[model samples]
Target: MLIVRIPAEGIEDFRAYEDAVLPLLPEFNGRLERRLRNPDGTIEMHIISFASDADFENYRNDPRRITQVRLLEKSSAKLELLSMANVP
Candidate 1:
């Protein structure tokens, strides 16, 4: 999962960044399983999954994704990454 913190002014830019990038997930055998946002819009959580760690890494390092880093930078967004497993 990704926990994101956004500044008020950065919200549009952040959403734009997400819109531009999230679609690339499937190329790496990944999916964005869910997205949740706080009522105040200060925080967002994205649940993502990939076939394997290597696929995730591949997605991260993909040139297309790298190019979109500017959109994320433009948004001045802050992010925290978490790895999760199901409770079974």
Candidate 2:
């Protein structure tokens, strides 16, 4: 999962970054399960899954994604990634 906190002025840049990169998920066997936002619109949460660790690594290293993530650098957004497990 990715948790994002953006400055009010940076939300557009953050959304643009996500818009440009998210479409590449399928190329690396990734799935975006859900995207949630706070009522105040300053925080966003994305739940994504990949077929395997290799796939996740590949997606992270993909040139297309790398190029687009520059948009994130343009934004004043803080992003944190969490590795999650499903337990019974």
Candidate 3:
């Protein structure tokens, strides 16, 4: 299992980023399984769950996603992408 945290700044910022990202979502071949917005306004985090390393890699390598991320980075005061292994 793969986990990633995307800091979106706030709910509005998350929504705006989601709106832009939605268009390119299909190209990922359904790799990005779930995306949840943190309920509290503290971190403004986006929790993403991916199936495997290959899937994660595919999404990361997509030029469209890369461009989208670059654009989002400029929009937010802080954007952090943290990769982790799922443990349970």
Candidate 4:
């Protein structure tokens, strides 16, 4: 799972980022389980699942994803990423 905190003003840029990267998920054997936005629109959270650690790593290292990261960095929005695991 990943939690992203983005400034409200940059939501459009973030959506662009999402549009660019989401297609790549299936290539890495990953899935976007959910996307949640705060009612105030100040934060966004993404829950993703991968078949394995290697799959997740591949997604992280994908060039398209990297490019999106750079674009996001250039935007006015700030972001935070958190990794989480399921608890049984």
Candidate 5:
């Protein structure tokens, strides 16, 4: 999962950053499970799933993803990446 906090001022840029990167996920065997936005409009959360650790790593290291990350970093005040698993 990815948790992102951005000042209201950065929202526009963040949307642009998101649009550019989301298309790259399928190539790495990943998919966005959900996206949540705070009612107050101050934060966003993205839940992402991947076929395997190898797929996640491939997504992390992909050049296109790296470029999008740079844009994300520039637009957000805080960003976090978390690993999650579904319990049986």
Candidate 6:
């Protein structure tokens, strides 16, 4: 599976980003696998798994996804896609 990792900075932006992106996952043939927040106020993480590599690519290239990335960058933060790796 392909994993998308978003590390959010602000709580408001984090929630807003989530709201904007969550619904589109299924459209891109992906699923929201998990969301984790650091109690120490470091980062809010989201893990999205896609059905296929092409689906992941579609999601990565989606205009809305680009917009969200820009939004995060504008907020002086960013997101990352943890390349395919073995997970237990």
Ranking by TM-score: 2, 1, 5, 4, 6, 3
| Candidate 4's TM-score | 0.82
What's model 4's lDDT at 39? 89
lDDT of 3 by residue, 1-88 (tens): 2222444444455456657765564565443445544465434445565556676678778776666665455445355677766679
* Residue 45 C-alpha lDDT in model 3: 45
**Cα lDDT of model 2 by residue, 1-88, tens digit:** 9999998888888889999889989999999999999987789999999999999999989998899787898888899999997889
Tell me the tens digit of each residue's lDDT in model 4 across 1-88. 5667777777778778878998899999999999898987667778888898899899989987998986577556665666788889
Q: Judged by TM-score, which candidate is best?
A: 2
Q: After superposition, how far is residue 36 of candidate 4 from its true place, in Å?
A: 0.6
Q: lDDT of each prediction vs. the true structure? A: 0.91, 0.91, 0.55, 0.81, 0.85, 0.66
Residues 13-87 of candidate 5 have per-residue lDDT tens digits of 788888988888899898999999998656989999999999989988988878777667777658888988899
**Could you tell me which residue pairs clash in candidate 5?**
none
Q: Which ten residues in a row have the lowest lDDT in candidate 4?
A: 70-79
Q: How close to the true structure is residue 73 of candidate 3, measured as C-alpha lDDT?
A: 58
RMSD of each: 1.0, 0.9, 4.5, 1.8, 1.5, 3.6
The TM-score values for the models, in the order shown, are: 0.93, 0.94, 0.50, 0.82, 0.86, 0.69
TM-score of 5: 0.86
The model with the greater lDDT, 3 or 6, is 6
In model 5, what is the error at residue 13, expressed in angstroms?
A: 1.4
Name model 4 segments beyond 4 Å from true. 76-78
Assess the local accuracy of residue 4 in candidate 4 as a C-alpha lDDT between 0 and 100.
Answer: 71
